[model samples]
Target: MRALPLSSGSVLIDLHTSWNSANEIPISTTLAYFSSSFRQTRRGRKGIASSSTPLSSSSSFHSNSSSIRKPSDRFSNGSLVSSSTPLLSLSTSRELELFLELVPLRMRNELLKHDELRTLIEVVIDLGRKPIARFPTGDWVISDETVKLEDLHHAISKVGEFSDDNRSGIDHSLHRISAIRNRKMQIIGLTCRFGRAISGNAEMIRDLVEGGGSILVIGRPGVGKTTLIREMARMLADDHLRRVVIVDTSNEIGGDGDIPHSGIGRARRMQVPNVNLQHNVMIEAVENHMPETIIIDEIGTELEALAASTIAQRGVQLVGTAHGMTIDNIIKNPSLQILVGGIESVTLGDEEARKRKVQKTILERKGPPAFTCAIEMISKTEYRVHHRLDATVDAILAGKLPRFEVRRVEEKANDSVTTIVEPEKHSLHESEVTEKEYNTTQIEPTEDFIEYPVRRMIKRSNTKPSSTRTLPVCVYTYKILEADLLQVAEVMGLENDLNVTDDIGTADVILASSSELKQNRWIRSVAKFHKLSIFVIKVI
Candidate 1:
């Protein structure tokens, strides 16, 4: 490879087939070909454009070089970024070939007939049933012949030993094979899931990965949770240059073998012999390996949740996935509840209860959450982000709506991936706010128990001047300086929205100290008559 001048966008390439001897990347050779071909193809093109037909994985397994992923360009939070280098899918053809071997010969040929072979999600082979090949669009019957004991035994022999978790994987590949045992403990069914370590899928949350916070990922099965984190581990290890360790319980993260797969890049992998002892391995990964980040999959059970909290306390960034549709599911689960701050009933004092305007005994967050942020994988390309798990969980416990961002990941024709974060809506259907509410920069003041969005907590800015103006919120301040009130509004940049008036009758809200509100019964009566909200400040 040779460099080109800054004026010319493309680099002059002299390609050769070679592998990195250090075992740094299992698919280094493929990366070399992909990088060179991509640059050569763009030498004279005016602009990359999109066609109606999405040819992504439409033709063959390695449809184009875009499937051969490389580390994406650096990006920041709260904005969109793209890359010239194409992102990767399963790097090598051998991954698919090895997985196909597990299927019987008759079924294997039928699977090859499909045009979108790249979209192959998994294959279900059950005893006395036709082998079914599932894709994102739908499922296909591979053959008319029913699967027998021989076909099951053939798949078992090709993969590594099924651990206590009943899941095995092909050596040096990310493909996973899970067994369904009979009453006598004989293998009756197999679910062969072809895992792809797509590098750029995790790019949407790269900011969180680098933020050094323990993040718990929750989603329904088959939403690409494991695949997303596999690349995240690689990104942290190779791009951010951090020490990352994967506690692979089912041998799915690092693949199966003493030699871990290169899909995780330079990150090391620790194999858990038994699923029951996964927590011990998680702890050992932190203590023995001295890693800055630890990645775990299927973090269920109380012990695993406790281990995650312990690792988080020890100052290790953990990226793990659990069983749930959303963060609310995890909070409601008895065993996995601790991962998000556990809920405990608290009996508030009479004064305190009145202050919050809630019942005397109510549910409250028990302690600080182990994970700082929780993400819901809504789909392969969309994610619902709870930027602060503690605040989100608190709001949920208080029976208030939690703040979240719905991000859609799109790949542009220019070979750049863009992450667009939508404001304050979990989904398009969940959005009840009007266009004005969605774009409002300032917090709309509300009283307790009022359903107000929390987007202002994350992003606050000055509003551009509009032709129309609403009535200013009249604030009657008691036992406080009027200048101080004006100054505070100015500091928050909400002066335009504030009206500091001395008249109590015209006030929408009363700003008073705790001491003054108790003594001034007249002010309280005036506020009550006008249906005004009182915001109390602590007395010094």
Candidate 2:
């Protein structure tokens, strides 16, 4: 017999003619031996079952290993077990069984024996085509049996009726079943997706959740955005004792049923009657329920964005997920721009432009952002968090890369650990206060540049002259228009004292265009280390 390793930690045995003839072992006896071998190898053993049919018949068996064991036995038996081990680990075994019950008996038995059922993601069924099972690693044909009309109908009848979105789910389960229909409104194809309630997925941001501020999570499809949101709601409602309400649209967050899944803890759920009315439901959740915090999934519309802002303005914290990968995606999206503070272009006057040394036109944030923090999920276990959304957006608009913290979760056999990584030192930009310092520097006007009326007014004021002496300011321009600076000095009547230099080490102030500042981050680091005032001007 040859043994093949499966991804689920199970082994597949193939009985060959040589072993069958040489050992003359009965099929039943061989099956028992293999089952017992699996039990001894795996810890917290559950049950092991096997079947023995002809190799060509495509018969197989499956073993389910329990994750529980008595504390005394675990330690006395000389096995490595700890009190911190996860007790109820996530698995799709129950969902897979429910789905397999709808398939043909022969094909179902063949598929049930495969070890991949634990990691099954979805099942695809079409008329006159063989059914296929999809897993994270890859996909494979479940059986050689082709699906027929009766098979499709049997699957449909087993689940709830398809809704307007052509999607349905099993009762009290996270598994979603969607249908593709013909012109006559007859179901022709089906896709069954298995969902699991995974715990500890939101540990990376537990601090952010506990801090109580509006947070927006963004990621691509299937990156577990909804799962994280569900976990966050549960943590806040159950652990922190916060009044949380979930605006569940399509029944994805709370699950599919009148009663929500226990994964959401004590949080109450408000189901949207229609996808288009999600925004209305969001408002209703705030005004009618009076929740301290609102948890929403997939904020994708203009009205929903506005509603999010309104909820934040009311001083109610929001924990929600949206459609995008990064803050840049939110800024580029027209309908969703308001969530991150919409962008607008403004033309600066010639004098103002020369003071900053940049183009006349530039982009600026329109208003306060609805979300105070934004999290970008790089993967299931990794995230990039922007704690200061307003500052981050302003930095990005100024053509400088925003500083963000990287957080990742590392899972071990006993427990999971979270780590936060700070951005590189070179990526840091000078504070806005530092720029304001340089803006405060006084420059007395020259007699040749000052208007006669202004000179007369200054002379008539009888203002007492200060003892402090004005110092000559040497400015260094990098990627900043030299002509703009000269024009600025000429208008201010300080052309003689306001000297623009190329060497940064000899200058007191370093000025650069915003676009150049973002591209050249090293310059900012050098200026910061030397305690030099650096100013960034936005360019068109």
**Highest-scoring model, TM-score:** 1
Write candidate 1's Cα lDDT for 280-366 as tens digits: 999999889999999999999899999998999898888999989977788899998889868786787898767754446666677
Give me the displacement of residue 22 in model 2, in angstroms.
52
Worst 10-residue lDDT window, candidate 1? 71-80
lDDT of 1: 0.70
lDDT of each candidate versus the true structure: 0.70, 0.69
Clashing pairs in 2: none
List the lowest-lDDT window of 10 residues for candidate 2: 54-63
Residues 78-123, model 2: lDDT tens digits: 2222222222331233334445555555555566566766667778
Instruction: State the lDDT at 528 in candidate 2.
Output: 56
Q: Could you tell me every candidate's TM-score relative to the true structure?
A: 0.65, 0.63
List the RMSD of every prediction in angstroms. Answer: 16.2, 15.4
Residue pairs clashing in model 1 are 69-87, 69-88, 83-416
